[model samples]
Target: MLGDRLGEITGSVTYQRVLRDDDGMKLETSFQATGTFLGVSVSDVGTYVTVLRPDGTQYSEGRGIMTTEDGRTATWTGHGLGRSDHAGAASHRGSLCYQTMPDEWARLADVLVLFEYGVGADGATTSEYWEWK
Candidate 1:
């Protein structure tokens, strides 16, 4: 994703992924943001759910998928909640691509993330990244 600060309200993001199964994939990700929207300093938690198509394209459901602390840092993590095309599968897994803004953009908020996922009987893979704006 890519965004710019409009006086106070600023946004930015960039993402990409690959398929790891034949049953399709599901990715749930969250982020912490501390920034002023419309010049009003604000802080809040945001979350999202991405349903991956067999061809690799995906869609996101906007909801609170992560949490933030009293300060300015937020941590995000998500797991497989079944697939869009199948409900009887034992499990599903995939990867996540994330980016963060600069501190000057978040004057009041910051973003942190812990991403993890699993494929079939394999265990989970976890990674971390940070962003502020």
Candidate 2:
């Protein structure tokens, strides 16, 4: 079961590039966002690589770091599958695992998170996370 929503972030795609084309069309993208996570203010930055499969689906893996307003940090990695509309919009669902600095927020290390990620044609991005129960 999915639990309460843990966080949400709105950001912009900072960069994107074609990485390869031989087997499948692979691309790398990076983004930046600011939002509240685990009830604390944070800034996030991440990069992900995606491959366009023959059936028009996409597979991606990404890793990122989030820093709290006071300097504490956490790291996360995730994988997801999605499809584009061929008109510059896409949506994905994935799982995320996090590791945090051993502090008050360390409980995050024991939690499994599920996420919904979306990108608009103009490069806007939104991500929402929920705890897995």
Candidate 3:
């Protein structure tokens, strides 16, 4: 079941590159974001690779680290399947698993997070996360 909304972030894509282009196109992208999680303010940096098939469908896998104002950190990994629109926008719904440094934020280590991620045609990004209970 989906629990409470945990956080939301808005950012921009910082880097992108085409990694391959034979049978399918493989692209890599990195982003920077800032938001709040469990009432704590944080910033995030992540990189993901997406494989775009000939049919306009895509699969993505990514890992990222979130750090608090005081330097506590958590790492997460996730994957999703999505499709690119004709206008170049893409959206994905996925799940994430987190590992937190032993601290007050350790409770997140036991939580499952679900996310919705979107990229606009202009390279803007937005993400929202919820707890999966």
Model 1 weakest 10-residue run by lDDT: 116-125
Off by over 4 Å in 2: none
Pairs in clash, predicted candidate 3: none
Candidate 2, residue 27: how far the Cα is off, in Å: 0.9
Q: Over all chains combined, what TM-score does candidate 2 have?
A: 0.93
State which candidate, 2 or 3, has the greater lDDT: 2
Which is the leading candidate under TM-score?
2
TM-score, per-candidate, Cα-based: 0.33, 0.93, 0.91
Pick out the ten consecutive residues of candidate 2 with the lowest summed lDDT: 99-108
Candidate 3, 24-122: lDDT as tens digits: 779898999988877888898999999987777888999999988888888899898888788988998888899655377576687779999999999
- The global Cα lDDT (0 to 1) of model 2 is 0.88
Candidate 2 RMSD computed on C-alpha atoms after optimal superposition onto the true structure: 1.4
Worst 10 residues of 3 by lDDT: 99-108
Error of 1 at 108 (Å): 22
Shift in Å, residue 48, candidate 1: 1.0
Q: What is the C-alpha lDDT profile of model 1 across 84-127, one tens digit per residue?
A: 32331122332222233335434323332222222222222222
- lDDT sort, best first: 2, 3, 1
Q: Which scores better on TM-score, 2 or 3?
A: 2
